[model samples]
Target: MTKPIRKAILPVAGLGTRFLPATKAVPKEMLTIVDRPIIQYVVDEARAAGIEHIVFVTGRNKQVIEDHFDVAYELEDTLKARNKTAALDLLEKHRPIPGSTSFTRQQAPLGLGHAIWCARDIIGDEPFAILLPDVIIKSQVSCLKQMVDLYNGTGGNVLAVEEVPDDQTQNYGIVELAEKINENAAHISNMVEKPAPGTAPSNLMITGRYILQPQIFDLLSKQDTGAGGEIQLTDSMLKLMETQPFSSIKFEGRSFDCGSKAGFLSANIAFGLDDPKLASEILPFMREMLDQPEAAE
Candidate 1:
């Protein structure tokens, strides 16, 4: 039987330069979309998918993320004293299963592959999931959960993918589709890292969510820098692909690249409309704003 995917590695060490001044002190993952911090949503997605342990690859100024997950005793006590049981209950709901989350440091801004490899010791020998906190993919069912369900049955290596425009394919790692696994999945014969214009095999681009075997660590270790001279995860994954199976789980959902200011603002609005309590008010406000003369420009 395939081992259940119980552990997840979250790479949160990136210096979010796009949001500079705000991120100079605060880690980008701590930025809130509506009420919850960004990483919190990633954690929630993992938990919803039955992930038992969360391994965080962190860096300097990322301490706030650690503190965010730790028990806030004083704050909890204050809420208790003020008779804020519901508020406390909400916090309690989101806390990781006790003793299930661990943190390790990636000392430098090397690359995504290196960040993932930093948690090698913690991940041990099991297959694991990697969640990119900044790429929040929204669906009625969380994207990670969808991938996890598929992983349980497929059992090799699974990546969450979505279609991108032909012109936009150059911005992402495009995969060559060989065969269809199902309506929402396909066998990956090859993957090209940001292929040149008109050379992409298919428009199906690899998005963030990934479930990979522990063997990827070895591949990542020997990976040479690619693209931006950083150890690109795509390079290692391709090497790993020679021996193992790789499939892309097509995710048809709204995805927000929170690494940019515009993307962050878009997520706020998208998620705001998705929220039941806020949607009724937010939708009308958005309609009114869009109808304005200034918005036409």
Candidate 2:
């Protein structure tokens, strides 16, 4: 039987160079899509998927991320005293259980594999999920929840994949399918990180969601620097595939690559359109922008 996945690791150690000036002081994870920060959205998805423990692999200038999860006693008290019930309830919803969350410093920006390995002690011996905060997934069924459901049945590594154009496959970790396991899932024969265009094994590219086994820690421990002299997670995952069965679930969700400025802007617009209070105002503003002659020029 597949061991139930109870923990989730979030690697937020990267310097958001793409976001530039805005990320200079504030961690990119704190950047809000509409109202909530990016990391909060990821946490909410994890909670929806039944994740009981959250381990954040952090780096320098990342203390704000830790404090975001911590209780704000003075703020809560102020709300309570002012009789602001609704506002107080919203803040309390994001507070994590004391012992259920943990933070570990990654110290250096080695790579995704190293960041994930940093959580080894906390993860111990069970399967766990990894959700990249940069990839904000908007779905009816949360992306992590979809993977958790697949993990319950597959019992091995499960990665979230989406079909990308052939030419764009080179920009992502491409997965080769050995066989079709289901209508929307398949057995991943292998995965190659950022394969050269036209040389990609398949069009199914891995997104940021993953349900991984504990054995991956062993592989990552011995992993050498691969592409860009970084301990690439895809390299370790490829090694793990040799000894374990791996599967890929084609996630039925819209994923925004918030790591880039364009994607971030797009996410704000998409999320804004979904917000009931903002939609009516935002739509007309967007239409006005479209109708403006200067914007066209």
**All-Cα superposition RMSD per candidate:** 1.3, 1.2
The parts of candidate 1 lying over 4 Å away from their true place are none
* Per-residue lDDT of model 1, residues 1-297, tens digit only: 778899999999999999989999999999999998999988988888888999999999899999999899999999999999999999999887679999999998889999998999999999999999989877778888888888778889999998888999999989998889899988899999989999999998888899999999998878578878899999999999999999998876878899989999999988887788899988888899999999999
Error of 2 at 11 (Å): 0.5
> What's the TM-score of every candidate structure?
0.96, 0.97
lDDT of 2: 0.91
Decoy 2 TM-score against native: 0.97
lDDT for each residue of candidate 2 in 113-218, tens digit (9 for 90 to 100): 9999999999999999999999988899988888888778778999999989998987898889988878888899988888887899989888999999999999
Residue 33 miss distance in model 2 (angstroms): 0.7
Q: How far is candidate 1 from the true structure (C-alpha RMSD, Å)?
A: 1.3
